[model samples]
Target chain A: MDILVCIKQVPDTKDIRLDPETNTLAREGVESIMNPFDRHALEEAVSLKEEHGGTVTALSMGPPQAETVLREALACGADNGVLISDRAFAGADTWATSYTLARAVETLGGFDLILCGKQAIDGDTAQVGPGLACRLDLPYVTCVQKTREVTADSIQVERMMDDGYDILRLPLPALLTVVKDINEPRVPSLKGKMKAKKAKIEALTAADIGAEKQFIGLAGSPTQVVNVFSPPPRGNRTMFSGTIEEQVSQLVEQLQPYL
Target chain B: MDYFLTEEQQMIVETARGITEEKIIPQRAELDEKNEFPTSILQDMAKADLFSIIVPEEFGGLGGGCLEIVLALEELARGCVGVATSFAASTLGIFPVLIAGSEELKERYLPDIAAGTKWAAFGLTESNAGSDASGIQTTAVLDGDEWVLNGTKQWITNGGEAKIYSIVALTDPSKGARGASIFVVEDGDPGFSYGKKENKMGIRSSATRELIMKDCRIPKNRLVGRRGTGFITVMKTLDVSRPGIAALGVGLGQAALDEAVPYAKQRVQFSRPIISFQAVLHILADMAIQIEAARAIVYAAARHIDSNPKNMSKASSMCKVFATDMAMKVTVDAVQVLGGYGYMKEYPVEKMMRDAKILQIYEGTNQIQRNVIGQELNKEYA
Candidate 1:
């Protein structure tokens, strides 16, 4: 089985502060990290390749700086990296992003499995994975918490729910949007890092992937960001001070009307 | 003159920084208080293949050398020198094996040590032989196919915890230093016992205990290199490893400066931030300059050891002495800059101060290092 993992580099949320005066995100000095969910996605793909002999290729669509994440993936045991970078791909919405990725997948002759994070931390939209699967005409499972089994023709997985989880079997060549519960990501090995340093990252442009100009980048996106602002603080907020019991009773008294 | 790091070297620094910042720094205080060996952190480092930085590829390593180890250690010590010491001391133990172990011994020991499945420790320091390795009283005598060892090695970093020990023992006492031989002793060997753990002033997170070898028996195959070649092997290993200690010093000095510069900026005194004061500014300047100079020399020495191993002894001692002394002064100045807060345990500088002290003492004290440099100078001038 050949596995493809789609990863993203997002601003570390821990360092992102809300500018109260401007009602906007203050991203100064924020370090970019591999999307936490995407790390689990990559870990699952690598583990699968390890258990069953196969090749794992990491795929990402971003600016030149995004190549860092791809190199990181290689260091974490990916055999190859495909960086889909182009100036024309800037300001792409989820729809265009998925279309571009799907085209890249087709350009690479597809794979037996495709894995992605359930959602990116920066944009909690959770639309690209399913959209890519739809464009490729393959079945996909979202919020996959566990992989029950994987074989040549099919894969069994547990899709997480609010209360419990649902066991589902999907045919091979399917897509998966994995949650963080899948597995612990391994640290990159030194040998893997040496290989990454020497390895030539295969770069592709929109034209190289045979993507139509009308269906890629900002020009192809349907949705636009009208405004970006932080939510205003709510009026009714209370601090529970005192011992645990007193705080609980005080909170109960305050919530009596709503209850 | 080219100070730029290779892409691979940059990656090593980045990777080590990530692990140290994310994993090691958070647990440092608690580990220090408990004086516990960083076993789990080592496991994490193993996962990152840090143990393989110095081992050869044929021995199941990344095939890196002194430069790579220096890169990783500097980043690691920046986070916590105690943790870095634990990591570096294992490499020190493996050095003798890598330098002189037979092919079969390398195959038996190097792979596991490189893979980080087992930790290794060097056993040269003793109660009576701190700087004078010629006085190492540990003795190993051949009895048929086996060698019996009886001695106590003191102040061994990773002594009780490590799985393998590279011990320097006198095989023929009459020949003095020339009679010394090194052996690889496994943890489970008969008559191998551990003494009381030493409570230390700095790098307390690393395990320091006495390795008591009472009638310890090992196969003759465990002998590293030819008989009576142990002292030279030890010297060469230290010559190669000195830069690692220098890198640790540079990292600690940098860590101290890291704390001071920010605190100086934010800390208000005399109705303004302390950084506005000329005194504070000059202190910061001196700290930065010293650390950079130390770092430059250390990097040069490490690269020289990797590329030109034959004549690195003087350069190695220069780096070790210069960097460690710089660390001691820089850390003390950092504490001074922070004033009361620096003295308090709430801040990291005090701990860094404590940690910086050991850098000057271990791996050949600054006094011994000066001796090496002076001796080299005499030989060159003569």
Candidate 2:
């Protein structure tokens, strides 16, 4: 089986700060890490490759610095890496980003499986995985909690639901968006790190992939962010301070307004 | 000029964190309560190639740098400070040998340690010599073809369980600290025994005992470095080990803060989450600042040791002093944030506080660290 895992390089959320003036993410001097959810997806892909005997390729679409995530993926056991980066790809919304990624995947040739995280923490718009699948016209599964079985013809997975879970089988050449419930990613071994340091990532631009310029970035994006603001402060809460019985009476009195 | 950790260092942290969370944390309280030596955990750590961390790959080890070891210790401490303490001490005890031992000694000893088949202990302090190691009365007299060691080493981490010991004894009683010598004594040597285990306030899971040596005989070949170099070796070893201890402190502190942040967010005090209160938020913010500062110093010390081993004593001392004290304060504040629930043993912050206290006391007291910094500063002025 041939696997392609899409990962994103994100700011370490613990230190992430927003620019109040422009409603943009502050990236200066901020440390970048592979998105935590994407780590699970990469782990799943590596595990599948380990069990079934195949090559795993990590692909990402971002700035030139996005190669960091590919190197990280390689260190974590991916056999090959590709970086889709270009200034023309800036300011991409989910639709345009997925469209460009779908074309890039086509340029990279065929694969048995394509894996991605359920959502990126920075955006949280979980549309890319399914959108890419729609563009590729392939069977796609989202919120995959576990991979039950995989073969050349089809794959079975446990998909997470609101109440419980559902197991589904999709044909080969499927796309999957995984949750944190997937397998824990393995740390790179010393040998794996040395290999990653030496591995060359195949870099592609929008034009290199023969992507239509109109459907590439901000100009091609259908949705635009008009405004972003923090939510308003909540109303003050009443405190009931006293002994248990007195507090109960106070709580009941406060609840009377809602009732 | 990369300011962040190398890829290998990052991998080491990840691997160490995984092993620690999965294997060590669950057994921490049990091991402490039972006064059990974590032989199984040690075995698992060995399986994860932890023992080979500091040993050079040419010598059949992973060749991890000081930063890597610090990272591993940080993760391990997050699981259990005591277990991390013991594991780190073993590495500490063996470093002098790896650094200054003869080729024959290195070949004979390092392989077993690297393989995790044997554990090592450093014997420097005695009943009378806690911070003032130069005051130790342990004596090693050169006799014919062997050295006769007679003394008691107190508060020795991994004391009773270690198979190998690097002991510092007075070789020339007339020369004070200059007279000290380091010797390698294998376990089960004649007249070598261990006292009862120590009952401690924290890090109780790690075995700490008094090593008693009476006429303990070892071949002259076991003499490490020169006759009067033990004091220097011990001090140098501490320079490396202190960062590890600081890293442990930082990890424990972060664990406390990590727990407190979420707890404050979810815990309701008066119809709203405690985190919504300015006082609580301020405390959390302060704790975060302290932890980050401690982390910076700790990593800086590790980097100093790796980049320039000759001038790291001051950096290491500073890291140890600041990080440990920060841990004590942060853990206590974590307990405060939890209110009455924090005092209960059911909450991890209490244990974390208990564990944090030792960092201020061990690997040389914060006062001693201050002295080191002062002396280094004065030397620069002079």
Q: After superposition, how far is residue A197 of candidate 2 from its true place, in Å?
A: 8.7
Write the residue-wise lDDT of candidate 2 on A1-259 in tens digits: 9999999998988897778998788899899989888999998998898899899999999998899889888877899999999888889999999999999999997899999999998899999999999999999999999999777799999999999999999999999999998775555544556677899999998888989999989888999898777668999988778799999998888789999
Query: On residues A28-72, what C-alpha lDDT tens digit does candidate 1 reach at each position?
Result: 688888999999999999989989989999999998888899999
The digit string of per-residue lDDT tens for model 2 on B1-382 reads 2438877777677767866876887888777777778988887677556788888887778898788899999888888898898899899889889878888889988888888889999888888999898999999998999999999999999998999899999999999999998999988999899996888888888889999999999999999998899888888889988999999988998888888999999999789999999999999999999988988999888988989656888999999999999999999999999989999876788888888888999879999999999999999999
lDDT of 1 by residue, B1-382 (tens): 3579987788788889877887888899888888888898899899888998888889888788898999999999998999999899999999998999899999998889888999999999999999988999999999999999999999999998899999999999999999999999999999999998999998989999999999999998999999999999999999999899999999999999999999999999989999999999999999999999999999989989989656889999999999999999999999999999999988999999999999999999999999999999999999
Best by lDDT: 1
State, as a TM-score between 0 and 1, how close model 1 is to the true structure: 0.87
For candidate 2, give the DockQ.
0.10
- Measured with C-alpha atoms, the lDDT of residue B216 in candidate 1 is 98
The weakest ten consecutive residues by lDDT in model 2 chain B span: B1-10
TM-score of each: 0.87, 0.64
